[model samples]
Target: MTQNQTHDPSGLSQEQAKVELLQLQAQLIAADQAYHQDDTPILSDADYDAAKRRYQALVTAFPRLQEIATQLDTVGAPVGSGFGKIQHVVPMLSLGNAFDDGDVADFDRSIRSYLGLDANQPLAYTAEPKIDGLSLSLRYEKGVLIQAATRGDGATGENVTANARTIADIPQQLQGAPEVLEVRGEVYMSHEDFAALNARYMERGGKTFANPRNAAAGSLRQLDAEITRERPLRFFAYSWGDLSAPLGNTQSEAIERLHELGFQTNPLTQSCASVAEMIAHYRHIEAQRATLGYDIDGVVYKVDALALQARLGFRSTTPRWAIAHKFPAELAWTHLEAIDIQVGRTGALSPVARLTPVTVGGVVVSNATLHNEDYIRGRDNKGEEIRDGKDIRVGDWVQIYRAGDVIPKVADVDLTKRTGEDVPFDFPETCPECGSPAVREEGDAVRRCTGGIICPAQAIEKLKHFVSRKAFDIEGLGAKQLEMFYGDPDLPIRTPVDIYTLEERDAGQLAKLKNRSGWGDQSAANLFAAITEKRNIALGRMIFALGIRHVGEVAAKDLALHFGSWDELAKALDLARPAALAHRSADMAEDQERAEANREGRRAKIKETREAVLSRLELHLAAREAWEDLVGIDGIGATVGLSLSDALANAQERAVFDDLVGHLNISAPAAPTQESPVAGLTVVFTGKLEKMTRDEAKARAEALGAKVSGSVSKKTDILVAGPGAGSKEKKAQDLGIRILDEDGWLAEIAPK
Candidate 1:
């Protein structure tokens, strides 16, 4: 770790070090194919950089390490058999990164200061998000793409023409007829696709991807271009490497031209009139970045005027006219005032750390998730929760981090900051919200409250779930509005049904509720009206509204489509319950027999018998006939059915559901559309798309007749592969389904 004498760990002598450096250079040249040129990262950035740095250092320390030029200075031809190699007309280079906003601002100031321009000069700048993905240089001759190469080094890159052509957004031919052009952009994965892919990977007993950038790299570099075509890879042009003539005089104009030429550009990109405006734009993007569909490491600011850019050109590793204003990695240190327990809908207790308000990644943070009780308390010598050492006691300082720049999580606690007065924290034995005894399941971490429907927190969460976008989608009946409706002293609306019958309530009480100081009658009426409009919910939305565990929007839709009708689904579920009960009875009978056979005498048998009795009593109360029937539904998985049945069958939950259903209709389904492109056949889309956005394509296909499934299955009839399609395409190919490119897909659905 120290500043060393011969820091090389390989322990090669000077002569040997020179040969090793040359070998490393060659290896690195080839490794670029696996990294940038391909989707698979042969090594992590840190590992790759360390090797490159070591080689560079060796070459500097002993000049003999600089061996023969291995054509590393020139962009290598594409290696994959499916794609033909095309030499880059101009060199593609990588930009040096500035870690913080200060560094970027300094770069900007230096550029301006070097030019010796007065403050009065009309200095315009264009800012765009810096996508963390492979950098590609796309060249077009007579408006059509002739080549595509990676930014291997400053001078050259590996040819990836066939792979690049698979990217939907990347134009095969430019519009507006530019004679010669070379555009630079990043290829990336959407957050949704990344999450889906990782989920599939985990489900299939495969390793999860660390990040989307790694996922994109791995997808792009596959030996099969078909695999690359399936990944949800996207491209956004930022700059240019070669041009016969300028597309426009200004940087903004060039971007506009690119957009017009069928290339997807970042919508957030803006042309600012001043440095202050540029900084404002940068901060705006940083603040809203968490909700952005794709990953962006930072904002890149470029001098808008092409003439000025030309005059202020070329640094060793960056353009003098442009600088990236990087957002600091989100971090926060807050006092862990208390850790509260939250019982999930499925009876899992989650530990949440209450914290002093702190700003991180432009959002105010006052709470952090502790994940589990074990995570809250530090581990002991046996790697268990420390009994002697301090647990996450009241008033402890904790470091919180947003991994991949989302979700506030407690990273670590500062034990040193703990006061001696702080006592060892004990998790709550009962639910704080409903005073029910907390129960911990075997092989589970947190203890859950047995309160079920009576819990106020649970009720609130359920309400929020009911009105969620994928459920009822009552626009005005948002969380805040729901809270207002429930908490108002003037109005006694307490259940989901209460929302539908808001207008029918006493006028004086309603007026008092609506005109209660902050919110007006108009807003209250709007909320009620919105809730009323969603009374006839679709089967899928109704299923989601029930707030079943692990039943997300996609799963809900899948169930709805498969079951077709709620009546049929309900009947199926009802029939399945007795079977489940019989199964449970068998389990209980087996347990009794086992206890009788393997008793450590009568005392052990007595204890086991008592526990079994208690368990049966709980199950009898928890799993009613209605609940069993619901769980039996064919499309409803055990996890979801059990949770739903348990919630609804609970006396208090039943009362709430009954009251809500009485006041409003919760069973509306949309009419099926006319015949369309994918009717009666399952389809799964993967990778970066060109012809239409994922949502658009899904909607269009659904409207036409396609049943879009998330995962690849034997039922799938077609696989529309785009650039970076990744695994799904590979799975589809293995399954022998028909494959279609963006154009092919367009042709299939085109008017006859």
Candidate 2:
């Protein structure tokens, strides 16, 4: 195993391993959904790989937990709902990753051992750049294009035939193609084209993608083929999925055949006779990566002989004959000019390092995220020393890297290169934008501005977030437009309520929007129409658009589903406020007690004061029940529940919510479309689920319209218990909930 694949030295018990495994599984699944389905990735490729490696290592260490490691066998995200689904004739399996030379050597050895060949025996392998773009499979029948689909969850994919036809590189007809051929390739955007597209999008006041891969994927997956055609997308056919007949005897020959058939194959592909040659070719590719004009994350290698590949066969989610050797993150050294604090929509005072312009991974980065004050202090959350405890200071030399080819991050500081004049960075104790007290709460890494809507930066960022794609997604009101309108005195949109009343307010104003610089009569009218269209919004979208801290899209959806409507949700949150406050006070009291442990008098006095506060702000039965219900929802937990309740409890914030809802007709959460035996039932799974992974079970239940909860409650209609079921099973029994074994539960939710 490589360094990145190293497992923890301290052994974990079976229960501990299972807990960690489940957590990892959830995180990985979320990452996959974000990247494949949502076109937004939260974790960097390196971090994601590292996490997967750890998860795999844990499973290997505890073979008993292997049955629950189903996510490891999954190839991609589920097919998106936007397009028609197509089942692939041949599953588009993912390749196992090799991070270093030792891994490559091991891969070669494994193949040789499997083939019963000596180490000195010759083994030809074909190597090519692993393009970091959207995977597409083009099906051709009798030398004519038939269908095109994206690689969704390996077996099934989204049909994008119309969009595929728009790409100039994808040929409409192939003269020498077989009767049935499924050509697999990558749809990519060149660096120049990606830059141009982003520039155009910015000019038009639209949101731009993070990278070329995202740009290409988002472009190709457009509902409108005209949009896809407008995007400069290119394709390079490198592999074949379903073929009526064999293309060639060797992988290299097959690729050459693809090129001959009028499909663009990567020209740099080479056939290597040995592992050493393969490594040499990989190095050559890495050297030319920046100049390639397109993004390639790694190099893929496959057994040359078709017969040998067939003999090698496959793993659960990857072909045994092939492996992708991934590239390490690119790093560059630059001078740290200064550190600046930027307030986010959540009022997080994020420290960013302004650097002397330096190119890293082919992109010139002038700024990098410092993460937080802890990062600058060279200490982790546990106060453990990192980077040799070298605190970052202005004028110090810094090593920067683009993690996953997306976010620029400061990796390390060069203490030796730091000038004597350099001083330690002092993070601000007040909001720079509004001069309000910026306080760091207990256990929170970031210091947040308490200015709320009074903070100009936070207000503008929140407005931008409110109109973001995942939020209201107003067509004419993008980040640029919102910023412009926020600064304009005549057409100021300071809050979510302001957005709805803009048209009415504008009608009475002398400075009409139609007379503005970028606004024509039609455009102005269209903006109003778009805003009006969103007047009747979904409960989940409205909650997310409110920009409440810790309450993201997923949390908002959970809340919406639980409460069903705005009225119920608002009432519940309002009642939950007192209990949530009491909980916070108790936690603070505990902290105070811990701090004053040596001084009994002070501790007693503090405890008394806390008791008095709690008693005076006594929560009624309804309030206590409300708080329980809010926290009881699956995935809400105490933290999110507190945030939600607090947001509604604050007088100033409550006014905003009230004003916003007053203008809009907010709809209740939509009911599940499909009716099944488990529909409308709250199901909880506990102990070891032998039949399927926890994630799989949750997804299955949700698909069948069952509400899957983490904890067993009075609301739980059924509890599925497996081997070693403990507290949850006892709780279910106490609550008089229906219980079922794994097989029994499976039978209950079976097709009939």
Candidate 3:
């Protein structure tokens, strides 16, 4: 703890210390992202802690790095944009780590000292294997699994309910559970299953994960739950986050009750009366780790009594009464041979590190992701210089780690070992597969191919997305089946429209599909029937299935509600294109003129702006209104608006969309609850719903022909007031909005 003998890694100067602090903060943040966000870790825990210590020492040594200290207050970075964020009722906390018996003793001693207990006093603990997998919090209400969230940061998480539902280990309904219960657990992939998955990916020339943990995390976070369903993911319930009522008197009793309530509880979890017993259990679990057929990085010891845990309380980022006794980190040194770019189905150009084969953590790793171009260019994702500003180059000696049995990632590059021949890997400006322009948009971390359907990868991915769980969801038409059919010269399922015509065409050159390999008469007929069943699909589903860039399920819903029908949505897209183009052209020209004028110190009016405006007179009222309406939607910003408009305007994209729409009947948006008196009325809900969640209330109102809006405006006809309703309730009263309690609102929608 003493810094009197501290040697300055940044040299002995305040300015150098400032630079060092920034580098440390950048390094720590990047490590958190690699470990938590990407499910891949480059640094060992000890090395990360050492860097933190050095950073803290520098900050203490210099008075100028206070801002860096402020940033340290935020434990992890913000949640990624790929999923919907959920604010936890009770913050999900991480556990402090203990690497040896000395740390364990200190942890036990600290707990006893906090409680003012004597040396001989027994401190009971529950010790269990810390599963090396994705942490999930499953909320159950009225015996039904309502929602599932991933532990993104300590305070917030990403919703993964759709993906969670696909796991067989997860219970859909609990018979003996409380009215409200949140069961926390780890979702993992068995070693056998992980191997099988990698084998399949290898066979298909698809992505093979670095380890089981990455595979589990990637599979669970998939946008399509069907992708998750096919992956062998399992859950082990070990803890609880939020609950309305108490399950038992103690932590051990609570876990037991969970077992009795049709939930899976860790069998190895046991109560240890003394620190010696806890250590013995920890050792036992450590010995069994390899034979468990799954990954476990550590053993966790927590206060067995719920009351004691509460009394002990928590730190900023971790619990005080629990500590994770982590095993030593696995690491190895390898040679970076090359950096290869691979295009994904979404056209994302991912950079992969081709490394000389190295044995790490009991596996030979030859490949790892460079993450993005920024990472390879000696900078973190935030543009902060990393690796001491030494960019990764070919023939570099790189240190790699297989943290938590997950992805092997480059930790550091040995610049001393680098030769003059070693050079920076240039990320491609064009797609290698399709030779299309690969563009990285402003504010985007990824570079994507712009070839659209002309790119084989994009077309296949789009087709897969079309039949995803939230889209068409044809029962027998899965990703594997689609992949097989798409590549076959005999079959015609290259596009969404082609899928509709499968039954009408011959199965193969050999014979009909029923007579071919892997296909029977019943199976072929079932595929046809399933496809037919989804002919009449929801409008929102149809929009989502189109796979328009920047359009997700929520966006699709917003568009559907705004348009009300497929015809209107199509017409809006069609009309909005030219208007958006004209606006963009004008905006760009004005920007260019201003820049040029600023540089030359002279003012000049752009003649092109007027020309674009004159050219767009043919836009008509529909085109103008379409562009306005698209941008006016609550969540649809100008960027997404432009993307949608451009997608609709593209010749190939429009052709594919047109063909798909021709074979389908998109059901009209359900009319506002005509039976209820509040039908077609704008409704605002405030505070917490006791009988149901906010999402459920909104859905119920929307189903009854009510338009649910977040704020209480002049347009709001009804306001559902729940307990703790504050600003919105006052606004409703000010606007003379009809406000009703939870019971009163339910009564209105109730049958007479």
Candidate 4:
């Protein structure tokens, strides 16, 4: 179950495979949190993708494991706390990745199989460059730009409407657009612009970004609209989300439609008739990648026909109809000069390698992630040998690899070139920042500092995350400014509450903020105004701002929606605290029992422990009810539930939470729309859909306010049955539910 352990399910027992699956899930979650939430990736894209492939392979080998492997169903990290949340009507899912031609062929074969098409069938696909930048969704109402959001956790996104309006490539008005259209695309910066921007930053003594993708993302997420406007950012429309009406009958036609509507569509987008053609187009795009000016990690191939795409539908996190054929990772050899342990917001001790500058894929790589102590020691989580058991050390020549704009990572160590003086790195057992003990918990890959708020590094990182674009984004208070303020004795803003009382506190200070370095009266006033503006914030934003472990924007929003108010949420958490604790104890006991059973070849003990835990849990009816209420909300699982309850249960944390909430007005979450004919109704689709794909039907129904279910239950209001309708259809009939044919279903959802 170690982070780097990759085992064939065939070589392991079912219990062992299950344990490994769980470990992979945890690792992937951490990876997603780092890459998407913190904008700091612990693993390279190539490594992360490989881990996912390994995870999928295990699930495929042990089919029953799929039931518990829920992490694969998620996309992106939770939305950060700062910006307004935009619920994506149609979730912006990710694409499956194909690292090689064989994978690409497999992708095509899978699509064909799902659609019941043979290899000789002339199924067409459109291949376009997958831009290595931030994903954006532009919502247009009445052919005019209404809002813009970043892909935050797929289900919901951060509102960047003002910043988006500043980009010239994004059209403010689309003449031929539908009444409601969500144009999805990439917000990117060209190589020239990125270089120029970095040069400008260097001239101004500001920190320069590492690559165009990072530059584009940082620019787009700016708190100040003017800052975003100043950045040379561009957008390319390639897809649609939440469309009121169809853009076109096919994928290529839809891109043309987007182009006609004044958005910049990729000129290299081409429709191919076969897998060979798709591969050829991928190669063509790969060849033109460097000359494209913008960053593109791969070429995306999507089913050309819109109807077929609908039929292909989507996996939990990725689309079934599309795949990204990733370009091979570029590698270069460099000397490892030093190893540095950096403490993150969550107290994780992350090891980074200082490398001799070398060019990889045209970008100079000076540093790479070591991942953890185990990776440094050339061992996987299971103590298995990796990198031929060649441990990395200072002065060692290491092979570093970079894929697209992903952060560089050490691939292997060249021990043959190692100097006599080179020695294995001695990872610290104490927090280098605060001298606190750094502990690595059981089953954890990385050690963490127990310094809590006392650790300056952890404190500063948490503060930065608090004021970050996704969190309580106060203009004029960026990471750089916050770091400066954190160390300032006169104006120390170490906590969230301090940010709120700054203006009042500054009024009485000997030297006011306006008189300080890099500040003026207007700028200080603007900062105050920004802080005040966020005083009255959304419930989800407030929850996310608390920085509770495992409580990201999405989880916060789900809790907000279920509780409707802070008081209710607090009360529920209080009641569920004991139950959550009990459940955690039970889970730990079950894990121990399972492990013991696996070792002793006894399964009875595991079942007995589970049943005992279940019985004990039932004894506390009120607590169990409250816990169920919290976890019953979709996406709120045991991990998040435990974290939420524990955060509230802790006296110190509760004091901090209370102090912070006292300064803000938290609004209730927005309720779902209920005006449509099928609003509030549960719907199920069965059999082989003809007029449209089952996914398309479900999307349409949900858009019209219906809850789409995979199964026909007693609560099912309607069943849309197709030609091959079987068990679900029969169940609906047995339940006496209303049944509609494909045509009838379409008619039922048609505009009044």
Candidate 5:
């Protein structure tokens, strides 16, 4: 989309340049959205920027493109409308990014100089990784999540309540929280999940996603619940918006308060006293980005003090209090000698470009994903074949770059450097692992081997996922344990059932197992007990333990809540299988109808299906429901119900499950209702509270079902203001509100 800058040797008219510039601008914006928001980039950043520069030149020359395209205008407006407009309690402003160590140091100097505070004045900041995903706001009233919206225009956003509810880390009901609160954070996919998803996409004849961000956006934006459910998305709370009362006097304290309120805030965030230390933290994260499990475009630095931040706040869009320090993008050049096609866990044959080792950033690169045959030969003037290019050959010497230093990709190629010895990459005709005939589906790009469980890659990854911490959480037995279990002939541990059978291992063989360095009698006993402990697992945990392709913690919880028991859930999934398969088989079928029907009938149909399946399958649906009901409240959704039905539909798996459940004793989730001493009351703390800080006072108030208002109103039931409470004290007196100083406020809430 870049305007042709070649002197227009033909002497093009101004109108032509203007037209080109506008088109280029549109293309650039679309590419940015795809790359940044959606994680799929149609153009490389370099290509996109090149286009932008060309557009900028024409805009500069004609000036008409500027008026028409307004390429330099602010970001796009927020879209969607699920939230009924409620004014943000605190402005949810954007952050200005600082690209390097110098920028961070300069930010520190600016804050220090602006605040007129010394180094010892305690400028506490809470730094967290800037998650590269979609931003959202969750509003809670009376401790329950009422609405969840996207961060559209900093003011209004699209309502995404259903999707938000699907995120497990976000609580449905707040515990020890304010009357009104808004939690903000990003929802993202783990790198491993992104890789898997991309593999699946290519295998299914679907367009391969560019990155995790695009995958997340595409998944979340899908109208179908099933699609969202299938995505491996997670939420990490970085900050908040609005509160009935100030969370903390300082940024560090506010983060702590958020964590205490049962919100899943990142544990890695820290406070730094100086810019030097801040830079250290930023660099450390940059160095460790590859191991962090998710992507972060940069690190965010914010002024520590709430009062100071308020004093020096606001710009047109970004807050003066906060800035993001971005790490430079990592790119590397590697020689492409060969391209290898490997079958994935989902049976997708992915083309990988094997490269001669080249250093990019700090990491050495030897391979890059070709995506598919189309990707291999796709190249523009640049040698790289990505979304913007059309196929690359095996012999091309590809220039590669890492988008965030975490994902290595081919950037371009030095075709002149190509040794003419290379050959065109061939699409695989059979699965490399299982030797099964590979077939590319109608729309799929990569061919897939329908090997299913027979494939080693699929079986291994599935097993690893099955015992993951969030799932079964079998201690002492991790990926290594599972690998050994699968590989060892004598142990022969293959499934969850195999773990139970471990207790019955022959005494003669027991000695051999114990002799293994990491395993001993006690360790083996613990593993068996842990496995046993999960028997009769909570319906939700059981669903998660199964390691279905897309089901996660939150979805599992929703399924449990909706169906109430394992039997009910199993029936629902069974019914969904036909729909999923049918939709998969039909090229023109609209998935939306099936999705909607599944959503509407999720609860009712689950109950009906449970009754029918229980009679036919002879599973104890009533007992399961009773167990679920006794465990406390649960939430169900179409995704979990479908997964459960699909998983249990196999008679063999069901038999294994029956045995697994019989031995497991996972109690239902704890009851939601707990009796707290502080409930249904109004309390306020003013001035210096001696027993605790202002944060502690506010936390206690909110915990006790009392609304904590910032300033006194006539409606204020009790006001705890101390010695220096000035105007707020007078307001309380004028409003005839009960006023309690520090000691008085403490005494009332104090446990004798």
Candidate 6:
């Protein structure tokens, strides 16, 4: 959308620019939703800014076109459906951006001209690092923290006051503050915290995020605030939204007042008297970016005078009184030494470009993602030309850039520098790890190997997942030991079952292990003991250890709670497998071209699909209506059910599973210990609880063997009502459901 994109204003007619503007708005909206609401970004900030700039430039050229856009003033995507949304009194405005020195100079000049001041007139502005994290607003009423919301679409936000109260940095009560103050800030995670949290996730076999910004956003957006409480989130107040009374006449003074009230405000903020000082401060912050410990993509400059800021007003999307000086994208040209295909735990064949050593954004990057086959073939998803329409080769020079402190990516290929000996890479058709057929389903972007645990790479990864913290969690066994033994022919820890009998299998090999590098006799025995100790495990842990696709810790626990024991779970899964498979097949056949014929043909197609599913699931229908029952579970969806079906139906996987089960003791999830009368019953809590927070109440209920549900149903055995409870209580009475006031519930759960 920037004039830089097309390089000529005359070449683009007003109508064409309007069309481009419309397209850009749609794209920006989608991108914003993906990044801000979904915690997933389809495009980098660099690309987004370019599109935004183009839109802005188009509107500036065609002033009449401004009337058509409303998103021009939008800050972030509107609050998503995941959380309760709250409206904002003052819109959280986004800042204009300055990508280079010329842009910065122009910004200063534009401001002075708008105020009818001399070009050399001093303009005091507040400069601070622009934290790349979730924007939040904290509202305090009568010097008491009352509400917290996310910067959703600038005008509306998600209420996260409970979660905000959990962060130690955010004071629950503030002193010496305005009666009604809405402090705007960024919710961020430091690099150390981000790394630690990511390590914990990896240890638990949970998905890890790309960067601190993403981690922070994902943490704050959790439906369960307890999940957000567990994350290492911090807040830095830098601005204000709405205030009952003015705290200060200047921006810096207001920020200082916030800091004085026990709020965590950035200490690096400085007052710049001129554009030179602003640019200097920007460079200073840019120089320290590598050591900041948190992610910051740029430096923000705001007009210090509150009155001036108000007078300057705003553009459709950004404040005219403020602009952000973005740091240059770190990129380096390096030789594409080789292209390597790595088989991930999900069996995805990801292409990685091995590059000549190059430092990007202060880190030495030796590899970058090639993305997919389309990227390698010099085309985008829509088959449009890219990488200058030149295919990348091993000997070609490529540009690697680290965008906004995330993973490095090969941005472009230098076709002119490609050596004559360079040849296009031929992607493999079979799994490089196990020789299994690699498949690319229709519409799938990446090819995945059909091999499950048979592939050594997949096996090792799965075994590592089995021993993860959320799975078996063996004391002495870890990823390193698993990989070491997976490579060693003498080791008995090749499979999960092998661990159970390791003490006996390695009795003579103990001394040998002691002699081997990085191992000793005592450590080996400790590992063996640890393995033996985990032989008797809860059903959920056993299920998680199996590494069934989409069967995470939560799903495993859900299944264990429902099925109780190993035999029961195994029987249910076996019966459910066929139904799940057939249902998935029918679901995948989205095209109705076959039904284009007459009524009989249509009926036959429908009957064929239905019969095929029922025929495969005939035995399972008698065994708990397998697929339907599975789909009804809280977390289980059609996709997950299908994955479970695949795992259970495969003969190799089943054999391996049974063999592993034979050596272990799998029990039901532990039953209640008579702590409460309602132990093992489903409980529903409604409204606010004075004695404890919602999280605390839920935790106590779960500890007492009650499944705490969000809503009351026929399955709900107990309904606990607190103050303000209305609908749930009325429903409980109509259903003749047992009801308890908060105090009554507490008394019932008390030790008798």
The CA-based lDDT of model 2 is what? 0.78
Over 4 Å off, model 3? 1-332, 356-366, 380-384, 401-408, 440-445, 507-523, 582-625, 668-752
Candidate numbers, best TM-score first, in rank order: 2, 4, 3, 6, 1, 5
Off by over 4 Å in 1: 1-334, 342-349, 356-366, 379-390, 488-490, 514-525, 582-636, 648-752
Please give the distance, in angstroms, between residue 124's alpha carbon in candidate 2 and its true position after superposition.
20
Candidate 2, TM-score vs. the true structure?
A: 0.68
- Superposed by TM-score, candidate 4 places the C-alpha of residue 19 at a distance from the truth, in angstroms, of 18
Per-residue lDDT, model 3, residue 659, is 82
TM-score of each: 0.46, 0.68, 0.54, 0.67, 0.44, 0.52
lDDT of each: 0.63, 0.78, 0.73, 0.77, 0.61, 0.73
Q: After superposition, how far is residue 56 of candidate 5 from its true place, in Å?
A: 32
| TM-score for predicted model 1 compared with the true structure | 0.46
Tens digit of per-residue lDDT, candidate 5, span 1-752:
11111222123345334334434444554554465445555553323333443444444355433333333322323343323444455555556556456557666766765666556666766677777787778899889999887665456566677767776678899787889888888888889999999998889999977667767766765656577878888888777887887788888888888888887777778888778878888887778888998877778888788898886666435666787765665555666777776655345666667889876643356766554555566632224434355346766767776433123456566767656765666677878777878886543455668676667766665566566544675655666677777777887667677777777773545456766736766676777777666554677667777655335454565445445677665554554455433323332233344555678875222223333433444434443433322222112233333334455666766777778776676554443354444444445556665555565566566545454544454445777887677887887788788787777776776765
lDDT of 2 by residue, 1-752 (tens): 12342223123445445445544554565566576546566653434544564555556456544534535555566666689999998998777667678778988988886777779999999999998888999999999999999987688999999999999999999997799999999999999999999999999999987778778888988999999999999999989999999999999999999998999999999999998999999999999998999999889999999999987776556788998887886789999888988777678787778999987764567877676788789876568776788898999888886533224566677777865887888999999999999998776667889999989998997787687555787877876678778888887888888998888888644235546647766777888999998888899889888877666566777778777788899898887788888988877877777668646544343454655666677669788777766777776777777777878877888999998889888888766686689877888899987656675677778778787777776778999999999999998899899999999988997877
lDDT of 1: 0.63
| Candidate 6: RMSD to truth | 17.5
Off by over 4 Å in 4: 1-97, 101-123, 128-248, 253-270, 273-277, 280-297, 307-323, 510-516, 597-608, 673-752
Among all windows of 10 consecutive residues in model 4, the one with the lowest summed lDDT is 1-10
Per-residue lDDT over 1-752 for candidate 1, one digit per residue giving the tens place of the 0 to 100 score: 11121233233345334333434543454455575445455453423433444444444345322222122122222234343444555555334334344455565666666566556766788888888677778889999998887765546465777788888888898767578889988888899999998998899998877778777866766667797887778898877877888889999999888888888899999988876777788889989988998877778888889998876655323456775554554567888887776655445566677889887643456766555555556642234543233457778787776422223565556788877898877877788878888886543454778766567676666777677544676776666666676677656456676676677774756556444535566765676677677876777777667665555454566567755765555554554454445444554666676677667455333334434553555545333434433433323445555444444445675566556555555444444566455565666678867656665576667666666755665557878889999888998889898888878887876756
User: Which of 3 and 4 is the better model by lDDT?
Assistant: 4
lDDT of 4 by residue, 1-752 (tens): 21122222455445445545555554566676576557776554434554565566566566655534544445555666668899999998776666667777878888766666678888999999988788999999999899999877779999999999999999888787799999999999999999999999999999998778768877888889999999999999999998889989999999999998899999999999988998998888888877989888888899999998887776656778887777777779988888988887667787788988998875677877777888789876678877888888988898887654235677777767966987779999999999999998766676889888789998887787677555676777876688888888888888888898888888745235446567766777788899999898889778876777666665666577557788899998898887888887787897787787889976546664655886866647777777766765545667778878887887877887788889998898754564578876777788888766555576677667666655565557888898989887887788799999988988887778
